[model samples]
Target: MSYEFERESLENADDRIVAGRAADGDTVAFAVLVRRYTPMMRAYARRILSGSADVDDVLQDAFITAWEQLAQLQDPGQTKSWLMRITSRKAIDRVRVSRSYTDLTEMELPAPERIAPPRQAEANAGVAALNEALLALPDAQRECWVLREFGGYTYEEIAEQLDVSVSTVRGLLARARKDIIVRMEDWR
Candidate 1:
C-alpha cells in the first residue's frame, strides 16, 4: 500500500523496481538481487571457466563490478541477463589470464531428466570429444567460439570484446564451427 513497501519485501518485487532501488545505493535491494542470481551466475562461470578453481574469484569480481556499475544498467528489468553478461565477461577474463578455457573431459554430469543412464555416458563422451576438438583450435578461434556459444554475446559484442573486426569474428567463428563439426563427425 505504501509508495515503496515492496522494496522491503523483495519476494514479490519486480526486477525493474528492485534493480532501480539497488542502483540508487540500496544495499538490501542489491543483496536480494545477489541472492537471486548467484546460483545461475556460478553455474555459468563454472561452465565457461571449465575445471578452473577461479570460479569464486570470477563471481566475486562480477558481483563487485555489478554493484559499482548497477546505476549504468540501461534496462533495470533485464537484471538477470545483465548479470549473466557481467559474469560471462568476468569468466572470460579469468580464462584469458589463466590461458585455459574448457576441459569438458574432467567435468562431472548430473542425471539426465529424460535420458537413460546409457545416454548420459554417451553425452559425456560427446563432451570429451568436443573438448578435444576445442583444445585443438587456435586461441582466437576458441575464444570466439566460447564467447559466442557460452556467453550468448552478439558478433558485434564479441568483436568489441576481442578487439577484432566483426568480419574477423565471423571468420573465426565460421572456421571454429567447421573444425568442431569435422572433429565431431567421428563421434556422431
Candidate 2:
C-alpha cells in the first residue's frame, strides 16, 4: 500500500489495531495513537498537577515513556487506560520533586479585570475558588479525586495506580469531596 493510503487507513482504524501497529514499530500508527489520546491525557495531567507549569513537560515525558515501552503493553485494546496511568505517574513524580523546593517569595498579583457579564464573573470566581480548594487538598486525596473524577478511573483502577486499597481510595475521595464542599460553601 502507498504511504498515504496506510496513513488514512490507520487514522480510521480501531485503537487496538493502531496500538498493535505502533507496537510493531509503525511510527505513523504511533503518531495516530498520540493524536487520538493527547487531549485527554493533557487534561488528566493538568488536573493531577494542579497549577504546576510543568504539565506539558509531564505529558511529554509520559509519551516518551509510552513510546519506549509500547512493546510491553499486554493488551493493545487497553492503550488509553495505559496512557492515562503513565500520565498520572509522571504528574505525581513532578509533584514529588516540586515539593522539595520552597519558594518563599510572593508572586506579583495580576491586576483585576472585569469579566464581560456579572454572571460570567461569578462563574469564573467559583471556578477559581474550586481550583484553590483543590490545591489546598492533601496530595493523596487530590490524586484520588482527580483520577476518579476527572480521569474517569474506577476506584479499583485508582487503587492500582496509587498502590492503595480500594477502601483507602474511597476514603480519600470522600475526604476530598467534603473539604471541597466546605471550601466552596461561600460561593453557593
Candidate 3:
C-alpha cells in the first residue's frame, strides 16, 4: 500500500478501540496500532538515528516493547504518546549502543510537496535546516522540541512524558530553538 493510503487508514481508526483490544491480547488490534503509528515512529527514529538502516528495526522493537508493557499502562487514552515515548527511547539506545565508528548520513523523509503547491520554497528550506539542526541536537533537546512542535504537547505534558522538571523542558526548548536559529542563519 502507498504510504499516504496506509497513513490515512491508520489515522481514521479509533485509537481507544485499538488500544483496548490490543491490551486484551488482540494481535490484530496490536497490528493495527503498529500500522497506524509506524510511519510517524519511523520519521522520528530516522531523525534521531540519522542514516542508519536500523530505523525500521528500532520501530519494530518499540512496538514489541509497547505490547509487552501495555498491561502496565494506566490510561488507554495516553497510548499514542506512550508508544511514541518508547519509540524515541529505543532509537536513542540504538545510537548509544553502536560500537563502530560509522560515519552517519543525512536522514531524509518524503515531503508533502507533491500534494501541495511549492510556494513555500524559502520556508521549506528553513524547515529543512531546522530539521537537520534538530537531528544534531542532544536527544533530550530534540525530544522536547518534537514533543512540543510536532506532538503538540505542552511544557507540562513534555515534562511528564520525559520525567523531567518543567523548567528543564523549558531550558531544553530554549536551547534547541536558539541552536536551530543560529544554524539556519548560517544557511542563509
Best by lDDT: 1
Sort all candidates by TM-score, best to worst: 1, 2, 3
Tens-place lDDT digits, model 2, residues 47-136: 666545787899899999999999999999899989988998898778777862111122122435765687676766676787788778
Better of 1 and 3 by TM-score: 1
Q: Which ten residues in a row have the lowest lDDT in candidate 1?
A: 2-11
Q: Give each model's whole-structure lDDT.
A: 0.86, 0.82, 0.75
List of clashing residue pairs for candidate 2 = none
Q: Which stretches of candidate 2 lie over 4 Å from their true place?
A: 100-116
lDDT (C-alpha) at residue 159 in model 2 = 93
Candidate 1 backbone collisions, by pair? none
Which candidate leads in TM-score? 1
Compute the lDDT for candidate 1: 0.86
Runs with alpha carbons beyond 4 Å of true place in candidate 3: 1-13, 98-105, 109-153, 160-162, 179-188
- For every candidate, C-alpha RMSD to the true structure in Å: 3.2, 5.1, 7.1
Candidates sorted on lDDT, descending: 1, 2, 3
